[model samples]
Target chain A: MATKSVKTAQRYAMVIDAKKCINCKACVVACKAENQVPLGVFRNWIDEETSGEYPHLRMSFDPEQCHHCADPSCVRVCPTGASWQREDGIVLVNEDDCIGCKYCIIACPYDARYHNPETHTVGKCTFCSHRVDRGELPACVETCPSKVRVFGDLNDPKSQLHQLLATRRYEVKNPQTGNGPQLYYLL
Target chain B: MREPVWEFLIVNYLFLGGLSAGLYFASALATWIQEDGRSAYPRIARWGALLAPWPVSLGSALLVLDLGKPMRFWKIFFHFRWRSPMSIGSWLLVAFTFLSLAYLWSWLEQDERQSLQARIPGKIRKRIPARVQRWLDLDASLWRRNLAMLGFPIAVGVGIYTGVLLGAVQARPFWNTNLVAQMFLFSALSSGTAALVVARLMDREPVELKEMRFLYSMDITLIVLELFIVLPYLIHGELSSLAVKEALAQVLGGPFTIVFWLFFMGIGLLLPLAIELYEFKPVILGKGTFHIQPRWALTAGGLVLFGGYMLRYIFVFAGQATGFR
Candidate 1:
């Protein structure tokens, strides 16, 4: 049962080629529009790393959202089971079930979720399951001019995402939290 | 300026009031059980029963008042969704209010003079219906007992829900943690105890020294736990940790420090602990009950209540201000 479950698990992941990212924030805008995210709260965000004080300053931007972890901390602490890791490894919120208690918000080490002021409930990225179900890429990935975000099923051996992940070394955000985020950043 | 702020404030007030009411009810229960002769347990219990519902109702009202569309508040009940904390809290508040009202009515109707007169068999020439009298007596007592029994957990549950609500948000580093709800629960207990103590002192009722001592010890323990839970997160070098540290520093050293140290720690915990400890020593040594002046108890209670409010305000504002920067 365990082997079959593992074998059949449709793990979806995103590989971001940081070198190719131009920091245009197209992904952020696209995600906001697609999700109808409220003002002052975001499902996606950019983290900037800076180096040098003066003469030679350089900057790098890392766009982040829910990493849809294999062992999601948000799921673990949720008292109502509103936040759950789907069979396909997608960390999703059943908005209808969510109590707007915001436990998952605090448990998330990455600060990926937000409480919608209008709805009085929690909201976050769901890896664009709606689009994925319709046989399309996530809005952010589709809108990205640089094609920096590579999304696909990790379980499929023939998938480009699977082949790339197998070949390249990548890092997940806040690995210490033990969430095992599916989103990987190429060094 | 923002709608979320109003929502946050409403939630804050509800939690605070619920906590205060819970502590009051608990102390009242202690009075009911202990039945000490000199102690003002009955009065306190009566007051607590009467007082518990108003704050929550008012807080709920405040929530509606702050709503952009006030009339829509009823929609929460009609369109109840288990997924919404507001929805759950709303229904809980309604149930709690009804329970509280029943409890209050029972307490108010138990007129000692009337009961004493009735106890005298054939004292009243006018015949009273046995069934009506029995029903009145039994129903009142039953409701009072039931409400008192159920009140404790419900109050605590509602109070703790506030912290859980905020803590559940993974997006805000300051508000996130399982400890958040526990912290909120402690705050509620502390605040509720303080409010009742203050009210009791105001009424010149012989305050429960033992109860005060217990509350003081609990308050100090909770504050210490809160500090312990926050210390590691603040000092950790991660980005979120650093942000939390910055916010903590602002609280510890900035404008909020006076309230945090002077009111919350010094007056709220330290002064009360010192006095209670002094009393404990004498009491334990068979030197008679430590007589705490009503004035001192009231002062301490007021400070503790202030401290509780400050704690919540500091945490909520600081958490929001520090996140993302």
Candidate 2:
């Protein structure tokens, strides 16, 4: 059984250039419209990190979303396999199968998923799988004016994301959970 | 500290339903054990069994109704996943409902006298079986008795499932402990028993005072134990200290405090205990039997039932809100 391996590796990931990000909130609006996310809720968020005294304070915005962790707690705790990790490493919800229990919303460390009041089902980003399938980037990436977000296959050594991650220092959110999130931020 | 209207409504329904079902089942068990005239006890048990499913089913339905796409509720079963507590709880509720229905059917078709006759055997069966062939069948009664006997475990199992569902979520520190399931189980039993007492009181029937006293005492003891288990966890700073402290504050002093202290502890526990104490005194005085004014018992029972529902609502919603923060 070990020798009959038929592996199909498609590790999808995103590299965000934090220094270039201006915290404009464009990506947030675009994501909401594309996914039809409910009002007063978000699939992605921009967390602000502040330092120093008020007059001279410096602030950094870290946009957050489902990290699409390799070891997903949401997937592990889901009683009905409605939340799943795609082969490409994108964590997505099968709305049709979801019981709307909100267990996944609780399990997620990033607070990425939301119970859509309209659908009565859990909703979140799918890495714009439909766009990706059509040879286009995610709505957030396409709409970002500063080109802060870069999307590509992590396995391809020549890919811009792979090259950036290889040569630059980066960070993943909530490293303590050891979820090995696919999204990275370049400091 | 302030809960949304939706949260309040949903949690209230969940707690009330669980308590109602639990009380109904416990009452049926009490009646069965007493073996009072079938008309005396079974009538009570039958009403309880019939009433039990409505609240739980309605509560669960309300939960679905509150969801984003209520129509897609069926998808939970279509693509069942063992990793989600909601899925497991849903399936368990379905099974419990079916089992309860069978139990109810048996009770409705039961021939109380024939069931007594069955205990005697042969000659009685022949005479009664021939004479009452049209209106009375002994076989159905046997099946109902057997099914109802089986339902006791299933009933408890269903009650425990609610707790296990919440307890299994390790990520939510407030809900991750084993005590949650135990707490849920105890609450279910307390609520279920209280419901039975109230129903009997309402019907103006002989309120199985002795049995009610025993159940009430047991409920008080379990609530005390549940409080003990909950205290250390609430005070400890090891697991998500901020969240735990916030939750404790919410229940003890925040908006939820009134419901937790005034309703759950006071009415659900204290009131029931006070009445039971009076009832137990008569029994201890060598009377062997006591008469509790049905109206008084009914009032106390109603308060206890309401308190039980409040307890669940406060815990579930408070736990969720704090964990999220």
Candidate 3:
């Protein structure tokens, strides 16, 4: 009889080299299209900042989405256990279970969650969880023109995400929260 | 881009929840008070018990209706996450409601019980034997006393939980303070007392002015305590982080300045406080008899209730508007 192998759980995360971002907003549009996110609302977006003055000015674009924190404030404040996380590190909203109290939205420091008018439930970036389960990249990761986002299993040493994180110096959006955000913005 | 998800419904719910908790405390205190030979505190206690259940029940209905999925509200009860203030709050509201109703039941005078029994259909009443009915009539006054003592802490918890709900969300620095809980507790007590005073003032039957004076005295003390908490809360915000300072600016000298200072502090608190003080100074100094006109009582009580409401409104709206960047 052939020996059976047990598969280890995945720790999915995103590493973004925002220095290459062209501010094209392709990821934002693609995320909406993939998620069927309602117009006037977004699951992800690009934040733009300008620094210096006159001839010495520089513009930077940071693609922003749910940080998928290990200690999610949203999950902590959710009364109905509707906002939860998978063991694989993907945070999600169970629309059926959500009472739409919106306390999760209030709890999140990043302002990552939004109230979905169509479903009358809270919504946020899911790391394209459905696609990730099928061995595909998230919509934002796949559609970025300049390859801004790298998505992979951090648990697997051989995975691009884990290798990049180990090799590169990166920073999280709000480290002060100590929420253990998974998204690493490469320096 | 985080809009205020909670609006008027939430504001009303907070105010009403605090009011209910305060009313229960008022009743419990009255129930336990040592009545002098001719003390009129029982009427105050009666008013408190009679009025406590309705606001919380109505407020709870509004709370459910405010939910995106009103029907799924029952799910909150099934999974009680102790860390979540919302979860704890749902359980608190449920516990408070049942206890308040039972407390009200216990407070029913013998004649009131007879009248309630008379309302029961004759067929149903006949089906229940006299012995069973007599056995059911265990000492309600004793039960009231026990329930009062038991429910006191829960009522205080409910009052504190209202503020803690917002305070737990550190994303909003304006509400992230121990002072919020303290201020809310004092305001709830004052509002609850004011509500009872209003009820008595508007009662069809005349209640003793002496009993009304007791409520006014309680309200005056509560208002002073509330002011102490509110002033420190503002100062604490100013002395904290940049985000907290900016959040407090909303009420201090920003958009909410006029409303906070003029309406909430001036008319709602100080004016009422001054009126009540004037009314009670004679008694406090042991120089003359306690006296207060009905119109003045109505005005003072109404303002206290209004101030309590505005406090919740400012905190909610201002907190939502300012969050960590």
Give TM per candidate: 0.71, 0.79, 0.93
Candidate 2 Cα deviation (angstroms), residue B79: 2.3
* B289 Cα displacement, candidate 2 (Å): 8.8
lDDT comparing candidate 1 with the true structure = 0.67
Residues B1-325 of candidate 3: C-alpha lDDT, one tens digit per residue: 3678999899999999999999999878877776673224887787899889888899899999999888888999988888899999989999999999888988887888788889999999989987979855654766777888999999999899899999988777788777888888889888999998898889887868668767877888899898899888877778887888888888888888988998899988999999888888887898988776888888988999999999889888888988767
Ranking by TM-score: 3, 2, 1
Q: Candidate 3, clashing residue pairs?
A: none
lDDT of 1 at A185: 92
- RMSD to the true structure for each prediction, in A, is 7.4, 6.8, 2.6
Please rank every candidate by lDDT, starting with the best: 3, 2, 1
In candidate 2, what are the lDDT values of residues B50-75, reduced to their tens digit? 67777777777787776655677777
Summarize candidate 1's per-residue lDDT along B145-259 as a digit string, tens digits.
Answer: 5567777777777777667666655545566655677767766776676677677666655656665655555555555665565455445523445545555665567666776
Which is the better candidate, 2 or 3, if ranked by TM-score?
3
CAPRI band for model 2: acceptable
Query: Which scores better on TM-score, 1 or 2?
Result: 2
What shift in Å separates residue B2 of candidate 2 from its native position after superposition? 12
**Quality of candidate 3's docking, in CAPRI categories?**
medium
lDDT of each: 0.67, 0.70, 0.88
